[model samples]
Target chain A: GQQVMQIPQYQHVQEGEDFTTYCNSSTTLSNIQWYKQRPGGHPVFLIQLVKSGEVKKQKRLTFQFGEAKKNSSLHITATQTTDVGTYFCAGIMIYNQGGKLIFGQGTELSVKP
Target chain B: EAGVAQSPRYKIIEKRQSVAFWCNPISGHATLYWYQQILGQGPKLLIQFQNNGVVDDSQLPKDRFSAERLKGVDSTLKIQPAKLEDSAVYLCASSFQTGMAAFFGQGTRLTVV
Candidate 1:
């Protein structure tokens, strides 16, 4: 069984500050994806990282996959009020037969203006 | 193209009652997944389906939870004799391929009293 863990279960930041959430998996993943969920809303697809040591950016947010494919991170620069939400990481194992997806517990972010 | 569709955005039932949630994934999507998300936590994978076939149900509580995807289009999740801990949001997502971006539907929020 694969398990994904996230750090900083809760994070609070002021406007214009930066925020980052880390994700770790017990097994080597073939690919990792990130998602965001606003309060009282459904989860939305954000990004996916496949190659090891890969880095991708979207506007003010950056996503990175570890070289060993066992971890990932999401960093948001200059957070705003609208950036408040929970971030989740899902990992897909390389040798998974049934395509089991393991999701991290998520990091809840709150931004104060 | 339509996104994943779910019925009964909300539900409230007694602890011993049974409840069922329905989901219709996006057209042409072969992979479907059901996740349970508790308050203050990320989505947990409950089951996955690939064209009406069960791919993964390792995390599903088999004693009380069951799900089915018929005709490879629509799916349903059932919880019999539900417990208070069953209060959470159930999300349905679909993807065109494995390890690809998944689009989630508006979840069904269930409250077991």
Candidate 2:
């Protein structure tokens, strides 16, 4: 079975600080997607990476996919209160029978002003 | 465009009771998914539907849970004889295809006493 694991289950940072979360998979993945869930809100898609060793950036956020396609990372620079939420990484198994995603535990980000 | 839609934003029931949640995916989407998110945990895929047909349900507790997406559109998830451990948020998501990114609904929060 394929499994995705994330580190730093919870994180608290002051406004203007930086934060990062890492994700690893037990098996190689065809692609990876990132999502964010606000407090009391549903998960929202942020971005997706397919090419190996790819890196994408959106504003102050940076996402990177490992060369092996079995790991990924999300980094937030100068975090803000609006950045408070859980960040999840979902990996699509290369040979996924159902083409379903396997989600990591997620990193809960809490920012304080 | 409208995202996925789910009903009963919140629910509370005692053990042994039965509850059902409904979901309507975005129009033109061909893949739908049901996930369970316990407090402080990431959403876990319970079932996957590829246009009204079950693609995978390996993680679903079929002994007490069941789901259906008739006509390859609207879907429903039912849980019978619920237990306290069943308290969680049920999220519905849909994507254009198995390999595409997904959009999620606000989710139905269920609390079994």
Candidate 3:
């Protein structure tokens, strides 16, 4: 059994402010995926990070994985109203236990315009 | 390519009632997953299927919940004598393989009185 914990359960900021959410897993993960769920909408795939100490960026969002592969973070710069949603991190367990993916509770974000 | 599809966007039932949800994953995806998402929480994996075979059902409440992917394409999840805690969104996702990121469907929202 594995658990992934995410910090900052709720965040509210002005439209142009920056925001970041952190995730840590109880066990080392082989890979981690991020998803976003809008209000009243289903979750949407965001990105995936593999390889230790990896960093990836999309437009205004940046994703990073720790060297130990047990922690990750998502940072959004100059957020907009459209960025309001819940961000989730899912960690894939190692040892190939039939792809056991454990998900974090999520970070709910509200962008105030 | 079409995304994962689900039926009956919403449902409402009393406690101890039975209900079912349907999902149609992507055409070529080899892995399908069912997740339950409560309000303000991330999705939790209920079951996973690999080509009509049950790969994981560790988190599923077997006493009242069951799922099947007979043809490896469409799947159904059933809950008999559901409890009030079963009021949540049932989400379906599909991936090309066991280790990849997944694409999710809109999800079925269920409410129990």
Candidate 4:
């Protein structure tokens, strides 16, 4: 079975500070996706990374996929209170004629204004 | 476009009771998934369906959990003889064919006492 592990189970940062979370997988993934879930809300798709050593940016956030396709990272520059939430990385794997997603434990971000 | 829809945003039940939750995926989406998310953790896939056929249920506890997607549109998840550890948020998501991103519903919060 594939498993994804995330570092920094919890993070507390002041407004305007920077934050980053790393995700690692036990096996190579076909693709990786990032999601954000606010308190009392459902997970929302943030972005997806497929190519090895790929990097994508959205406004103040940057996402990177490792060269080996077994790791990824999400970095937020100048965090704000609105950035407070849990971030998750999910790895997609195909086996036995089907696909499955393995999600990391998640990183809970707390931003104080 | 409408997102995935789930019924009974919250549920409270005694241990040993049975409870069910329903989900309606977005129109034309071919893939639907059910995930269980506990506090401080990422969502874990419970089941996946591709147009009314079961694709994967490897992580599901078949002894007490069951899910079905009839007509390839709406789906339901049932838990019988629930235990206190069954408390969590159940999320439903749908994605278009061939590697599209998933859209999630608000989720059903279940509390077993």
| Residue ranges of candidate 4 with Cα displaced over 4 Å | none
lDDT of 4 by residue, A25-104 (tens): 98888899999999988889999999999999999999999999999999999999999999999888776656777689
What C-alpha lDDT values do all the predictions have? 0.92, 0.94, 0.92, 0.92
Model with the higher DockQ, candidate 1 or 3: 1
Q: Count the backbone clashes (under 3 Å) in each candidate.
A: 0, 0, 0, 0
Error in Å for residue A19 of model 1: 0.8
Docking class of 1: high
Model 2 lDDT tens row, B1-113: 98899999999999999999999999999999999999899999999899988888889999999999999999999999899999999999999998689999999999998
Model 2: CA > 4 A from native:
none
Backbone clashes in model 2, listed as residue pairs: none
**What is candidate 1's lDDT per residue for B1-113, written digit by digit as tens?**
88999988999999999999999999999899999999988889999988988888888999999999999999999999899999999999999977888999999999999
Error of 2 at A10 (Å): 1.0
Query: Model 2: per-residue lDDT, tens digit, A21-102?
Result: 9999998888999999998988899999999999999999999999999999999999999999999999887443567777
lDDT of 3 at B75: 97
